[model samples]
Target: MLGPDPRTTLVWALLLDWLGQLLILALIVWIPPALDWSIGGTQLAGQYPWILFCVLLYPLLGWLFGSYTVLHWRRLPMLVLIQRLLLTAAATLAAVAIARWLINPGEEVWLVYRRVQVVWLVSLSGWSLLVRLGLRQGMLLPDTPRLLLLAGDEERDRVLQAWRRVPQRERLRPIQPQQLEAELSRLDVAMVLTLSPKIHRDPALRSVFQHLETADPRWIRVVSPERLFEAMQERLPPALLAEQGLNYDDLPWAVTFSIQAQLKRAADFLVAALLLLLTSPLIALAALLIWWDDRGPIFYVQERSGWLGRPFTVLKLRTMAVQSPGSPATWTQLGDRRITRVGGWLRRVRLDELPQLLNVLNGEMSLIGPRPERPELEEELEQHIPHYRKRHWMRPGLSGWAQVCAPYASSIEDSDLKLSYDLYYLRHFSTWLDLMILFRTIKTVLKAGGR
Candidate 1:
């Protein structure tokens, strides 16, 4: 807590950034008329927030992206900060474009928006780099924030004990009741951890909060412990579930039902279709090699668990020598003797799993999810491993968080390691996270790190 409050500085910085944008909006309206380049003579003022919305979205998006975090914002390099801000700007502009399309603004309105956006894109690019660089750097901003824990007398010890356990305890400056007003005036604390609901009942503290409502409420963010946990949620590994007091039952959606799910389905279908098409020639070549390698079948189909514990036949290019009837379903060992020469190469390149794209298209799998297991093996795993069936909560995928993040699982201990990543994925399923897995899968395949 020795330097500028990054969150407070961020607020001041963004206020300045937004003011520049507002001024730019005004100039776009004024400059055209002054230079006699007028188109329909300025209706931007009349458009209100409709036209001003994009300018406003700039800071809101920044907050959403945590561009101004309590700790890391000050330490972020100029290039990294610019990259984050640019992403926010891109998202804002995309919203603007979508809004314009949806509204179908008339010719003059459309022209005004297009011109303003073009100018904004060009000008703001230079603005952040030059004009706002110092502000974002927070070199000129004032005050170092203390981490405040708001607890009544009864709960103060409990709160302090909990606070001491967190790594951020170094930032706790311990503001006494009398010094609260002074701290507020100096903007010395940006976050208040309310450990007790009734702790804010003091007449002075209540007045301070009421003042916050009237003044800039951005400075002091009131955070309940639950809200803090919720913010920290989304990507909890199975290993940490006990520590976090969470269990497999906490993961929502027996079968995920939402727009996010539908979008995921659409993306899986489209990406799988495209990948299947693009890799057809490679798949054919691999199939021919596998046939020639051992005179075995090109495709191997096996019963595997799917979403909601449903059993489905999964398709894959055979990469193992044919097994005898009634052979136990066992994990293939590294450098297993059963793997044919060409099959080993196929596994190494992950080309053997290419046929699973058909499974993805058939809605039995996803482009990214927990890797499914053979039903026989899955039953054994369920018997021995806690929460093993939870992996089947989401649809099986050709590649997944577990598949990419973890190495090949031939042992129960290895499966446990992979399951942790799989649980993390289930906890934090999002479009962005799915895209991350997809990229990692591509990298793995490129590195021939498969099997």
Candidate 2:
């Protein structure tokens, strides 16, 4: 029943793309010399270094852009495919420009570099398109691993509808209650996606769950209806929290206090220090702008709930005017008149968040976790949202899964959705997942999609 893990699929796809690019580079180098056309009056031998540089850099950039992420390729949309190509080309060109300065290739070599860049852009784009098309048509690999669904009629229909929207829908096989035992005994099912509440309560089904767990601990996943919709939107699903007589102590908190927690803390400190040093000039510029605009305080400090629901002073570059007298705590909305002209640009590019790197370095926040909420909002949301306080199970972050996936939570409904994403992070916390969130955050900043 064991099959290729979804995580490794991305590595395989990346290797395939690199191979295709290598072939194109070889053709570009070999064919020109065979035809007696001197590329910028230099032999192809000298171009190998630059070609090798690109071969190494392309995959790194692809990974940075989430091009190699399994989620991206599993349901490859046309727009996402195009975005990957664009990011690849952009990264390649930027790498070339940086190399040109360092290598200081003379005028003759510079001409050759420009020519190769043009050819590479055209060939790589065409090759990438062909590879993606091949993957979509299933010409590059065998059929996807099949998912066995165990659920009641209503849940079965809902699960099927969700899977239908996924590009890998053909891999799912639904089993009826009467046929479940027989199918389990005979079929080589790799994964079981169940939505039936009975599986958690009924003695017989609970035994099945235990047997499956004994066979492969990760094989069976009890997903909630809300999780099903989240998956359809391509967001990671939160762990099912609705269980009979569930206790607060049953939550997955070991990860928050494990060796990985230590590693995350070290990373936050080191990375935050490095970023603060690198962005000092920009921070200075922002301060000057804020001061010039209204001569108000350049930094805003407020109390927010952090790890374990403890209060901490969070820092931010002021992005709004000084509050008028008697104004109450409120969420920043789109087109809010309180935003100064300079602050608007800072918020758009997320420059206002730079100061929080200090908080990260001080051990009060991590680079990736749930965004901290103000005390006023936190108190109100805790009263309205289920499991709202669970978000404090980990340190609050400067950028997180919810910030990247959902818009700013300005209402109760938005807060509910944001909590779901936060819980998903807590349930599935890992170094790889954190890296994905960081990359997505970069993409978001590049697109000016910040709040």
The digit string of per-residue lDDT tens for model 1 on 228-329 reads: 323432223333244444354555433347677788999989989999999999999998998898888989888888887888897789988899888898
Q: What pairs collide in candidate 2?
A: none
**Candidate 2: which stretches are off by over 4 Å?**
1-9, 40-49, 59-87, 94-103, 107-112, 139-142, 145-193, 199-239, 243-257
TM-score of each: 0.50, 0.76
Output the lDDT of residue 169, model 1.
17
In angstroms, the error of model 2 at 251 is: 6.9
Indicate which candidate wins on lDDT. 2
**Ten-residue region with minimum lDDT total, candidate 2:** 236-245
Clashes of each: 0, 0
Model 1 accuracy (lDDT, Cα): 0.67
